[model samples]
Target: MFLVYVDESGDTGLVNSPSNYFCLSAIVVHESHWQTTLNSVIGFRKELRASYGFKLREEIHCSHFIHKPGDFQRIPKSLRLRLLRDVIDFQASLLNYQIVNMVVNKKNKSLNSDIFSLAWQTLIQRIENTLYHHNFIGSNNATDSALLFVDKTDEIKLRNLTRRMRRYNPVPNSFNLGSGYRMMPTQWVIEDAIHRDSAHSYFI
Candidate 1:
């Protein structure tokens, strides 16, 4: 079995979003390595507290780290930079993982209003390729399945869009992740979207 962790940066709102780009990123990993990866992350958190006297309960948020807010305000700039670097290194150390990222340029005034759907479509296609080629679970096995985990904020809307696309051919005769042409229905994607706190969300 494979687990897909997904997260997005930037707001989907047309008018309120301060940023010009919206990015969606996903990390796919096999079940066997999940515990190792989770432990590595937990270890990193503990190391920060033990070595730097940082708060163990606090999450390392980029905005808070960079801006040095509240408890972070007392951290030295050098230490903050090092923390960021170590976090990046930890992410790079994951083995047998595939990353799928989509960046939407919202500068164009004529861009589609449903930019979120567009980004999701691209990500799903890449995910489909990973599922088809990677036979870690087994070749054409009926039990082949992947679970998608995302933040709770968008669970309802994202699931609605995903199910709609899966049920109907929104883009007929075009590149898509549907099971129309494959034995394994892309519908293998679980409808029950799992959600977690941003702090615990490694994908974010």
Candidate 2:
């Protein structure tokens, strides 16, 4: 079995809200099927763009379809709905997957540490623990490996926000989630496109 950990950027609450709560989540998908699911997502979006003269709204981060500074929700209803549908279709297309969500309250660390860090750690810790309980995943000789997909961070453009991520704890072995109370080294993949769309991207 393969583990694909996911993370997100941007405030989880209503867009433009003053709060500093960004949503961070981690999910696991079968390695054997990860590439297939990813390719499907790429294909779906490409098809939509070719079929429709206009681009979808949720692709807000997409350079081809970015919203003005003050307008994020002003996107057309049809485009927005399509975006949602695409996410749903992505999960349906996946062979199998499991998701874990972590909401970071960046405003005050009093209640919790950084959410981004927590999200990453949680996935590591949780996955490791799960494995310890279930023995090695694939085979007797199989070594533990995990990949994390992180959405690209904006340094110059969104420097302040990306800077916040710098606060996240850097672990030498962030590959495996905490396994059976023991920390093991595993591969971690950090893909920039992994974000709020991830939950939707890999939903059950």
lDDT of 2 by residue, 35-64 (tens): 766676566667766655334333434323
**Model 1 Cα lDDT, one tens digit per residue, 1-204:** 678888888866677679888788887776776787677767877888776667656767677778746778677877887887877887787566667788888777454478777777667656765666654432355455678788645666777766765665334333665444432335556555578776666554
Worst 10 residues of 2 by lDDT: 186-195
Score each candidate by Cα lDDT: 0.69, 0.49
